[model samples]
Target: MRYSILTLATQALQKQQRWPQIIAPEKLKPHYDIIIVGAGGHGLATAYYLSHNHDINDVLVIDSSWIGGGNTARNTTIVRSDYLLPASFALKNFALQLWDSLSQALNFNLMYSPRGYLDLAHSDGELEHFMLRANAMCLGGASASILTNSQIAEKIPALNLDQQSRFPIRGALFQAEGGVVRHDAVAWGFARKSSEKGVHIQQNCAVNKLLTSNGRISGVSTHRGKISANSVLVAAAGGSERLMANAGVPLPMEPINVQAFVTEPIKPVLDHVVNYNAGLSYLSQSDKGELVMGGATDGYLSTARRGSFARLEDTMMRAAQIFPFISNLRLMRHWSGTADIPMDGNAIVGRTEIENLFVNCGWGYAGFKATPAVGWKLAELIADGKLPEMLKPFALSRFTDGALIDDAGIGPYPWLH
Candidate 1:
């Protein structure tokens, strides 16, 4: 049933007790045309695109946990297209465009807000670097501007800009089109739409092994049973490395733990998503009035979905320096999620060495922003068997061809990226 005012009225008349299920569970079939591993936002979006755009509904998306229960739920939910590289800028700009219409297209309230994004610069060198990135973003069809210290102060008056303080604010790289969205809503929206279009979503079904026949993928062996498929695409994010390794494909990605915390609900004080470039901390105010904040990775490789308290303390200290008003805010909750960081700092997407196998992983800290674009491009690649222009630079073969897309110029370090 379409979600509209009439349906809502009817439901209201019925005492709001007999609503239809958002997505119905289905029994495992003998075979499928395509089997995608991982049921996060990216996987669900990929399935939706495949069924809706390509008219291919014989697809199945499996996950070990429930939908939106992974990194998709742990993220700070900031979305932006501002990047220093042309390739990344194009891909992310496309994603931002998709986010604009995603709510209406999926017939769901994603709560997307284009409140803007500000990347604070604490030093003159950082300001110059941001200027270069801003120019690149503008050239790639994303709105970006360099904000002076005075303008920054005017825009975000609550921010502490005292010159005597440590790491005083200098300026910021402002992207007027960047903002935040309800992260879980994105996943649920796609899952509902895909399921309604005849795509199967199976949770708690962990894939144990890749089933191959004579050099090509035949299917996957899950904890439930062996499911056969003509093609397999792994969009497992942090779990991508292990899944691919099981299929005898070694990926140059590491699973690292990244942490985030949220403060108690308070009056709205922040208007835009803020990032401290020098301190490596980013934060935004949620619709519920909670201050969501996060910082850099723990600088180690682990599949554990938790971080050390030391890292949390460091993040809080830096966050306090930027937003002094939150110095004494009571922390409500904190959590961590694993992200797959590639050596070159860019995502690894497209067909792999295995003939019938493909991968869409290694997004690191940028996955949430790139979900839509990645889904559209990966669906196009799988449906038509050709890499889209926007995704060609992210192909896994780039590592061997000596073509690395390190936007930060931090060479060959997964954690640093």
Candidate 2:
């Protein structure tokens, strides 16, 4: 199976169409060089880099449930690095470069097709933001372009080019490197490869509390037993605060459930991934030609993935507005995933007040796009015990220091999930 997230995340287990890999129980040791909590893409990728790049093989990964059972596998696969701001641009560009080499680096088929992604500019502000991002990405060696209405009309002929049709179909910013990949393949590719390299991926192992002594993190108390380690990386997505709270490291994050759904497989259409900035929604035609649409943050304090039918209704109505042709497509399946929504739109990735406990959460909806850079940088921090200059700015203390990355870069709001 190919790992399909825009970034190649070596997975821990794969649930495929047939012959799925089993997630079995495993006992945790009392000690390890490092222990990474939450066996999602970020944790697994960190473990992979720690073993491969830093040669630290005594690393263990613990997940609350089966791997990829979090937001890691639930995102609508869209990849781009054309960010308006500098920091988001830097991280995304770095991730794009790593994505370019992911297939070869993982020695597997990522099915990474850079078939170009388009961001529709409905209003003047949206247009301005796209133009600024186009320039930023261009300077960063990305093949990004600002396309006029005529050009958009030429590419997507089915779209309503008439004025006053909600969006009016204004100019669009096109990033040729922006594309979609198979999300599931990425998780499995990373997990299988990393597990083979001797990294222990323990699924269904929920870390209940952290064990610390004299202001230093030493181990973790889980559902099964306790495990000791020198360094502990809490890569948990929605469960970030629950685990880190025990260590006195609080993240300004609340796990909000984001829902998405797909239509039944139809004939191949909507070749390119389309995102309407004005409507704040995105949809991509999957390999099976199913229109996979996802938008809007949902559920403020709910942990259960109970997606509201109203969300499905609202999103479907919005989809019909964006692509009038999709109104006829029948709904197939709907699901929701938890998002570690930070107060600021940016992610936290660095050491916290707790001595050896690290964090890599608050991805919102765009973390899948930055997995490669995150894994590489997080590995460096874990192995060397120091945060790099770029990642240092996104520390957990940003909320208190007021140095938060309040970048509305790709998100809908400046301070929302």
- Output the number of the lDDT-best candidate: 1
Clashing pairs in 1: none
**Candidate 1 weakest ten by summed lDDT:** 298-307
TM-score list, all predictions: 0.98, 0.90
lDDT per residue for candidate 1 within 1-417, as digits (tens), equals 789999999999999998988887667898999999999999999999999899999999999999999888889999998887888888889999999999999999999999989999988998898898888887787789999989988888888888788798888999887999899999999999999989999998899888988989999998788999999999988788888897888899887889999999999889999998765889999989999999988878877777888889889989888888787799999998878899988999999999889999998878999898889989999999988999889989999998999887886988776
lDDT (0 to 1) per candidate: 0.90, 0.79
For model 2, residues 235-297, the per-residue Cα lDDT tens digits are: 888788887876788778776778888899987767787887654678888888888888877
Candidate 2 accuracy as TM-score = 0.90
Candidate maximizing TM-score:
1
* Candidate 2 residue-pair clash tally: 12
